[model samples]
Target: MRKTDLLAALALSAAAVLPAAAADEVNVYSYRQPELIDPLFEAFTEKTGIKVNSVFLNKGMVERLKAEGRRSPADLVFTVDIGRLNELVEADVVQPVRSATLEANIPAAFRDPEGRWFALTARARVAYASKERVKDGEITTYEDFASDKWRGRICTRSGAHPYNLALTAAMIAHHGEQATEEWLRGVKANLARKPQGNDRAQVKAVWAGECDVAIGNTYYMAKMLADPEQREWAESVRIVFPTFENGGAHMNVSGVAMTRSAPNRENALKLMEFLVSDEAQRLYAELNAEYPVKPGVPPSELIRSWGEFTPDDLPLVEIARNRPAALKLVEKVDFDG
Candidate 1:
């Protein structure tokens, strides 16, 4: 279906499930799947007595909001990836939030300096190495993906994918464009096959013996382990938190922003503050298998079992700014070809 039509259908589905508008309620336009966020919303409503209405859009959230202008029903926006969050800021669809609660709960590295967006959870871009073929420390840094040692033994999704692009942007932030381009070419030369499928698919390739190591997010390990059909694939690989030469693991976030045209401004601010609370952070960590952006909140036991590593201190906005250059390098390398 066309993107517009698909968004409309998703809106209708959300409307059909939501109750009639309540006197005290907040509306959300989310790129996150409903199942992943509904529990948190339910808990918020139960505690605060403010209803939460959400429309799950697969894409075009900024466009929809721009089109809706001052009449938009959305009070908040939620999405994965710094790139998407940056798009909201760039389009001026979201306004700055100045919640002391949010600033206190979240670290400086994970939030917008201007308070335009705040990360709810974090996930590292890690390596999934074959337990049988790759040693515990065989893959140490993301730079290792381009080493001659792993040629024809690496698997990843399209380099242009937001997840990969974010990583690429980070490389640029650290190594400069020309060097990052060289690194991209080297990594591309190492691909086991044409870039295909999701992060899970890359791990499945390792399980199938098509590759020795794959690039993917840390959360996928937990997700695969929970799925009955994909358990073997999860078991076949060990999670490796690779870092830059002198930096820590590469991390990305799923974040929230307040809409500029928030109709329920007061309730929306309340929800925003609530999302950073210990209860909400725990729910996010446990339910989604993500690292809580709020310090002092523990991740799920399953995620903890994978081990931990320091996250790179590079500001996410820098990553977002470097994205266009990263995409150009991906095209210049023809990474998926």
Candidate 2:
């Protein structure tokens, strides 16, 4: 064969071998419920011809990944809350991938600056008040919950709850630790009853007339509204969009990251890109009742019905960053008391 022709043939052979070198399946460790995240996985596989094998767990994924170490088959990690994602990154379990697609789709406030993770969806932590008992235009912000007027009328889950912990962290980030502690004290003084139960229970307290107001994630209301048995729990309350006195509502995210030792690196990246795309962002909203992180994607009907407001815009990383100190504050205040 002529030298030029032979070289071209070898290049074609190398190109053919490249596909074979890639991993056939991507293993995922996901904190999302299977039902909520499965459609996106199926769509990704269908489009890219890369099979996804996932272990869905509500918790303990971080410890599992640590235990497995380099022997782990996981190529990607997914979870709600910046703290969990930050925990994985801080543990050296996640690797950074600087993808322009990720940067463009997700806001800087919702992602790790180092590219360690990208938030896929956002949910506001806002208050729900009784339509009759709580006067409209009375409670305009989270800070107001500390006022004496709200004493014996406010309800909230324990501060130790991850959701409330994150919100408290945000408060500390914005108001300073001293001010945040003071706010907590005032809020505590107003609690109709001791902080207890999951966020859903707080809303139920509103329904039972035990409290006039409750703080919870936006999605919890949707969950309650959808369940026939829990309709009564949702019916008595109306969502109040708290402006937080000056800043917007406090928000947090569900995020995704590639494992540091990801065997299916390329496919893992493809899945990450697919997740932040407009189509998938909308799916995230529709399936999970959370706000899309991507700009311009309209929120699901449940969220829209609750009305729109500006988000707090405090960098979400701070929520994770302040977690330790926030927990300390929660402990010092005896938030469960």
Write the residue-wise lDDT of candidate 1 on 217-303 in tens digits.
988988899899999999999998999986889999999999887778888889989989999999987888999999898898888
Q: Give stretches of model 2 more than 4 Å off.
A: 1-22
Show how many residue pairs clash in every candidate, following the order shown: 0, 0
Residue 207 in candidate 1 has what lDDT? 98
Output the number of the lDDT-best candidate: 1
Deviating ranges (above 4 Å) for candidate 1: 1-22
Model 2: per-residue Cα lDDT over 187-242, one tens digit each: 88888898888888988889899999999988988899889888898988988879
- Each candidate's root-mean-square deviation in Å? 2.4, 10.2
- Candidate 2 versus truth, CA RMSD in Å, comes to 10.2
lDDT (C-alpha) at residue 167 in model 1? 98
66, model 1: CA deviation in Å? 1.3
**Model 2, C-alpha of 167: deviation from truth (Å):** 1.3
Task: Give the TM-score of each candidate.
Answer: 0.94, 0.92
What's model 2's lDDT at 270?
Answer: 88
